[model samples]
Target: MSGSPYAPHTASETTAMLDAIGVDSEEALFDIPESVRFDGEFGIDAKSEQAARRAVASTLADNDDLTEFLGRGHYDHYVPSVVDHLADRSEFITSYTQYQPEVAQGFLQALFEYQSMLVELTGLEVANCSMYDAATALGEAATLAERLRSISGTRVLVPDLLHEGRRGVLDNYVAGSDLTVETYPTADGNVDREALTEQVDETTAMVYAENPTVRGTIEEGLDTVGDLADEHDALFTLGTDIVALALLEEPASVGADVVVGDGSALGLGSAYGFGLGLFACRGDRELLRQVPGRLVGASEDSDDRRAYTLTLQTREQHIRRERATSNICSNQAWVALRTAMHVASLGPDGLVELANDSVRRARETAGRLDELTGVQAPVHDRHHFREFVARVDQPAEAIAADLEAEGYAVHAVGDHEIQVCVTEANEQALDGFVAAVSEVVR
Candidate 1:
């Protein structure tokens, strides 16, 4: 008999197994060093399922529900009841990748719609169904750019103001390749056009710029950047958020070769480590084939009825190891499904209104904060989307700590700079947020 109550084997069976394995005891199975091995019993006591659930709930109740004004990449948004209800269905929640076309048509179709919506939003021909997040999508784009035989360069140009997380991921992705990542200087939160033009050459493989930079400054001269890429035979990659895309000009109109960003803003809430990555490219077959992850397509079945299936699966698991485009094994299908359901529930006009309202609230909040004695609002003199930076006289960390004490959460980007985000979900909390800031700095 095993010592643990949870063990399945009887004493005779355990002895027989150990004898067959030529081991004296169960502890002999592991080659762990005795010095590092745990000697004490586990503190957790066995309990009923209901008791365990209540204990977990009680522990979680200790956490504070702070008002969020923080958005650099992940954002908090209004999730409609329909989105949660539809996504909570057992068939959708417990499902994995739709490898089999016959059994996964429903999920495949939902992902197809997700791709279609991204196509319309980005003005691109093809869109992949999934990616890990915006950072991974951008990293994948760097690798995809390297695949272009016509471009012989091994360098990727990124704005100096790019998000630290994104830059870190991009660095990790290109570490195995011969690609070199370099930065182009920024002028007032926008990529410096002159420096960008100077940096692009025959050795550059891609040039990436974020629409609303990490500092919440809207990037201008996108067409000029695209032209520079075209001149150097480099791919121009644009990174942005879905909400910003709804209010800004379509990426295709500015000659972007690849568009990547977060799709979670559509319906997903901010919980960290969860996001829907949006990846789209022009209708070029070569580009489509090189896109990472799966692409769902519409087709007809044996009965001549419309159907959906996974058309392109270029991940290492589906394709030959040597020919795989990416090693990314899992797709954010559930998150994508949530996004699709949220978008469908809101239609076109509702989405635009949601985006516009966010912009309005952000601008209004920035304007109000500028009136504070020690605050210099809109740190960058450029149009902002849902977030902005404010330069204050006091240390940003101290201010943030003070704000947190008052039930508010904001990001401290610099020594005295704090980034504030406004969304329809937290618009009503702006007044409280401003008052908290005033009290901190006063």
Candidate 2:
């Protein structure tokens, strides 16, 4: 046997396996080009499991413990202990997509509740269990719009201030198709209605705008945008922050045909890379049929007892490739479960209060930072939710770097603009955050 404890087989066994594969040597089995293959021994020396764990832990401990104020697409939010406690259960954490409804009733129910919650929040008729993230959800929304025969257009119009990541993903999603992505101008930190009206034409399939824009300015005139979309016979896709939705007006109220956003703000505290995409649409049958991801529905079993099951699975795995609404094969069930638990725990009143508190902190912090001579309170003169842009005298990067050195993390959105995000979790850190900005500016 190999001396390494991690090795799964003896040397003799490996040689026998190679022989069975008709390869004389292990190196010969690999198809890697000889010119690029490594000739030297690996630098990592094998260590005991415990020693390896300790080494990794020690190295991770060296990372700076920075207080976060960053938010462009991601935010640092407080996750209630109950949310983690319930979501971390082995059953929920390890479970994959609930393929078998009988054994997956609990997960299906949770996801159904998640869909219901999103429907309520967005004022849409139906919602899917989950998507990869907000960016991907937006891409799916565009693709779904393109599929609708009534909305016969080959272009998707996006706000100029849309997050670059989301725009990039949209570009990639439509790259292989006949769709063309274009940007509408923004004025005073909101989508310029005149420009949008001028740009949207018979060639436009969908028009998307973020409520709380990437620059952290609350978008105004959503109803007007919707009207413009109607004039062009284009779908109005509204992208928003779920937490802010607790306090902001429903997209459907403003005539949104589709809603797409991140659900992570509820309780999925920043894992940086992980997020849950929230998607919902109007009650139209055609719209529901085109929505991506999986949908959980409550129904009566053969015994006439109440039960939950996967109702409409439109992804490639469930349906034929030619008819699948989306190629996405997986859903964010665990993250959606966490979101459901968190939203249920907060209830309606608590969610509204949490959103209000976040806005309060953003405004208070902006006011305090504005007191500094070199900084403007908010880059835009509109109400903001969890984040705001602070126009500083120094280069935004330098200010952000200095703040980082002092153990705080903030986003530099422009040459002289720093986007600061404040959530309920950062309530106690607000003053310290403002003080850090003051010091950095000085």
Candidate 3:
């Protein structure tokens, strides 16, 4: 009976529709053919707004939630106030796909800027409309590699230490398709280069690796992996962390045929969970055409002014099913907007500073925590980013629980090691984290 601007129908209208459907009551309509339906109220005392807010806050307050030191993929960082202010702008928030490109000039320009920023960031030639997240971008990149290889002996070699979620997404993408994935093992948290080299033959379609790996150490060398893939007549694909490009080597420059990642590192918020999946391909004309999703291009309108529009798309559903490379559409406009804004705001110097800050902060925290009685970060190397896996005396979950009880948020990677993220670890926070770990060593 509550009235709201977006609520469509009144109770009477719903009742009339139910009556037209010949169901005497709402509960009767839900009766299953083989099972009984039960009608009962959910047992809960309804509280007033103030009381409910207080209750919810009280429950949440019971837990110790503090500044975190964990970055196994998802990291907490500084998002500027302007992000929320701009995201709330009606045009950006209300936009759909780039279907009406002319009317949605702002949206198209934003997409164009995202592509440009990514291109500049990775040193890649062509970038596309964003994908759902980093994981699916890898899936689509796998498919692109297949198409480049013509998919006959479509075997992709993914290194161990790949995120399980990404692996699942790849499996889902290749399921019932001609392509297959072969996973190589890892040694010392890096890809087994010799095994990876041995695994590749003329039949291999692609080689994929994540930089600084998910566990926070450089692998059997992604650039070397790319070179091998090329030697084996395979496409070199990168499942990179986009933000890391600010500090590390650019995959595209390192011989990656295709580069893609979750650009959530670009100051986007967790509320924007469906992150910006950044993708870029080498400028080989065939390779560019084979890239999935649309690309917004700068063109001149009839009046000879610059205009943006969707120019290239290999999504088979757009042209012909068998001919399409993917089903991901004109995508993630608003999320990409957040990423683009963050990039523009930071520019080159600010971005490098941010990236360096993350690494320094993480190193400081890991070094401090390593001094704790029962905690150690076993893998200390020259090429680690803002995240490192820390081994604690207790199970990772229990350690995280103890930390949380002390009003700290820690990320658990596996059984005994938690991923200590350095994305937003300032000096004070790092010191506090070191102290917290010291206190929680029991």
Q: lDDT winner among the candidates?
A: 1
lDDT (Cα, tens digit) per residue for candidate 1, span 260-363: 98889877888775898789888787787677788888889999999998876654556757778887777888888998898888888888888787677778
Each prediction's TM-score versus the true structure: 0.90, 0.89, 0.84
Q: Would you give me the overall lDDT of model 3? A: 0.75
Residue 233 of model 3: what lDDT?
Answer: 82
Ranking 2 against 3 by TM-score, winner = 2
For 262-325, candidate 2 gives per-residue lDDT tens digits of 8887768888758888888986888767777788888888899999988766545556587788
Measure candidate 2: CA RMSD: 4.1
Misplaced by over 4 Å in model 1 are 1-46, 314-316
Where does candidate 3 stray beyond 4 Å?
Answer: 1-4, 7-64, 149-152, 219-221, 314-322, 378-382, 425-427
User: Candidate 1, TM-score vs. the true structure?
Assistant: 0.90
The predicted structure with the larger lDDT, 1 or 3, is 1
- TM-score of candidate 3 against the unseen true structure: 0.84
Candidate 2, position 389, lDDT: 92
lDDT against the true structure, each candidate: 0.86, 0.85, 0.75
User: At residue 181, what lDDT does model 1 achieve?
Assistant: 98
* Candidate 3 C-alpha lDDT tens digits along 134-225: 78898888877777734345898887778888899999888856788989887767778888888988888888877767877754456778
